[model samples]
Target: MTPFMFVTDLDHTLVGDDAALTQLNQILTQHRHEYGTKIVYATGRSPVLYKELQIEKNLIAPDALVVSVGTEIYLDGKNTADSSWAEILSTGWHREQVLSITEQFSELELQPDSEQRPFKVSFFLKQEVAASVIPQIELMLEKYKLNVKLIYSSGVDLDIVPRSSDKGQAMQFLRQKWKFAAERTVVCGDSGNDIALFAVGNERGIIVGNARQELLEWHNQYPANHRYLAQNFCAGGILEGLKYFGFIK
Candidate 1:
């Protein structure tokens, strides 16, 4: 039997709430052994931080990790670089230059250094500030010919990553590498950053109830037959999606 692929975001989707995390852990652990499902985490977190969260929350590690917003990939317990992605992202990436450009915008506060990666830069911005600054930042990126994409989520978090690296692209890469059928893959996420993961057509998607408004709007604008909007939040939502897709009974 072909193994089903379950790719999910960590924060605000799978392991966000303690109660939800526990439920999700139980369900996944049980189904994983019974159904021969493969799990992957497509997250904006770096590998180091991902591990920290796992330890702190006592969460199960995924079979693979798509970290740093898809700029990095790790299998099992080993860290490995996706060189093809790296080469594609290298064209116009100058982290220091991107930082210097954004530093002029006082409204955009730098995120912790740990959040910074070779192919991604992160910042925090208030809703009002984001409204005004994001356009300007886009213009600056265009002017400088930087091949980066900016993703804003939860009204505060702003991530600038390589144009080719995102949760969706990373998930697709792993899915193909593992030989999982498109119809057998399910992705769950709850924020704007997760939009890309859902946007990957042909795969099933779950948008948890607590998802950001931006993501909901995006989903509404382009509804897919395979997408499920769950009434439950986080892991509960994931379970709902799994059942909706007939991955579980």
Candidate 2:
């Protein structure tokens, strides 16, 4: 039998209303125990924040965590760094340089230090300024020859990480480590940050109903049968995706 793997983003995609969360937890728990399906949480949150979310939102702990927008990986309740990922990020990345450059833009505000990670820097850009300022920011990165990638999501949140680090790359790393076939993997997400996950076309992708317009647009750009757009929001939508992909009956 093919080993199955389920990966989901935590924020608005998986964490929903109390009823939805309860149903989601129940479904996930059943799937794990009955089929041994592996579950992973892919998020921008650090392990610390993730644990807090687990408690505050009553989320189920997963088999593994791809945290800080895929720069770090933790397995079986033990926080472990992906050394290869770290090595790739170590060169050409200067957090202070990125921060100093971004600070020049009056429209950008540095996110709290708690959100910062060794290979990632986060900032908030007002919706109105995002359009005009992002290009300039990218140009600055280019000018500095920084080996960083910029991710803008929900029209306000911005993240900069090593060029090689992303949700999709992290998923790929874990999939290889776990030896799960691409055909048996399912990834669910709802924003721009998740585009990389969907871009891993060999694996299934689910964009829930409440997905941002940017995500919908991105999905439409490259229509594929492997990617499904769910009609339900949050956990309901994830369950719908699982059913659509025949992962669950």
Candidate 3:
């Protein structure tokens, strides 16, 4: 196997199937040891939530963790947060103002305090009403002149982060800082929030079979030869993609 950066979203993208996840963990861990492969997990989960999942699922320890919808980053299991990323996001972010504006909507339910970060404000908006409510929120933010981006996923989670902050942007930061070749990188995901992961780079991409409608729509709208839509679901999908991209045998 060639050395590559393996970046993935958790939840349904990498964790839905226990057996598949275990197999993937073993493969990634061995590659990290032998080939200097870098592994990253970018997810909407907070550090605390991620830790919980780590214990439950026995996930491989990634070289870097992008959490809180890419609002926060931690390196090598360090307790310290990455202040550099925070500084970059601080330029256009106004968390309090975001909360203040979003507070007006009764349809939006604030997520737990842990899930909220200095650069991210999250909520739960039902899928049925998200279409109408998101635009309204967008109008309010535009009127207020706030520079934030809204990301909705899992048919429920709504995360508002700085305009420049997201899983893809974060991954780009890591890739550039580490000098990873675009061709030697792979990103795996299964939802709308993961769309940006596929959009910004020439890195090989894997869209799992059991993807959400939003992601499927995006894949159909902009098909790329660099990306493979796998026939398997979850971690199995990732394994299939690694083969399809020739990252492994």
Candidate 4:
């Protein structure tokens, strides 16, 4: 049997229900032990916050971590950074300049220092104001000739990352590095940012039933038979999707 890659978002998508997550963890652990399945956790959290979640939720550590909205990748453990991925994000990324421009916008409330990374800048802007402020920020960044990508998720959280860096691109990098078949890669998410996860490659997708409006809208726009919209929520939803995709019975 060929091993497959399971990449999932942390918050809301995989951590909402303790019992469901525990069951999913057991299944994943067993799968890894029996078949060498590769697991990855992707999220917008910084390493510090990711660790906190691991402890608080008792999540099994993944083989790789795509954190800071895909601005950083960690392998072996949370402490070991993927230097190559870092190098990729370094090009055309001007964190300070991005900060300087965003700071001028009072509507954008800067997140804590820990949330800000070398290749990603994070903020909290209300949904109502995001429509206007996001474009304004984009225009300002364009005027400065900065190449960056803005990701807004869960309605309020906004992230600015290098144009070449995102959840999908990070997944692509991992797939290429690991030599995993694109069709065998499974991704799960429940928010706007997760849209990129579905867009990147031929990876099968599991969008939880409780997905946010942004994600649902995107799914409706680009319907794909490869992507499964699970009726269950969070980890349970993931289980439903895995079975639907024939990864499990």
Per-residue alpha-carbon lDDT of candidate 4 for residues 22-45, written as tens digits (9 for 90 to 100): 999999999988998899999989
Q: What CA root-mean-square deviation does each model show from the true structure?
A: 1.9, 1.6, 1.0, 0.9
- Winner on TM-score between 2 and 4 is 4
What are the lDDT scores of the predictions, listed in order? 0.85, 0.87, 0.92, 0.92
Which regions of candidate 4 fall more than 4 Å away from where they truly are?
A: none
Q: Write the per-residue lDDT of candidate 1 for residues 81-101, one digit (tens) a residue.
A: 767767877887888889989
Q: Relative to the unseen true structure, what is the C-alpha lDDT of residue 200 in candidate 2, on a scale of 0 to 100? A: 64
Clashing pairs in 2: none
Pairwise TM-score winner, candidates 1 and 3? 3
Q: Write the per-residue lDDT of candidate 3 for residues 125-218, one digit (tens) a residue.
A: 9999999999999999999899898999989999999999999999999998788999999999999999989999889999998999999999
Per-residue lDDT over 9-29 for candidate 2, one digit per residue giving the tens place of the 0 to 100 score: 999899875687798788778
Model 2 alpha-carbon miss at residue 183, Å: 1.2
Model 2 / residue 20 / CA error / Å: 2.9
User: What would the TM-scores of all predictions be?
Assistant: 0.92, 0.94, 0.97, 0.98
In the predicted model 4, the residue pairs found to clash are: none
Candidate 2 local lDDT, residue 166: 92
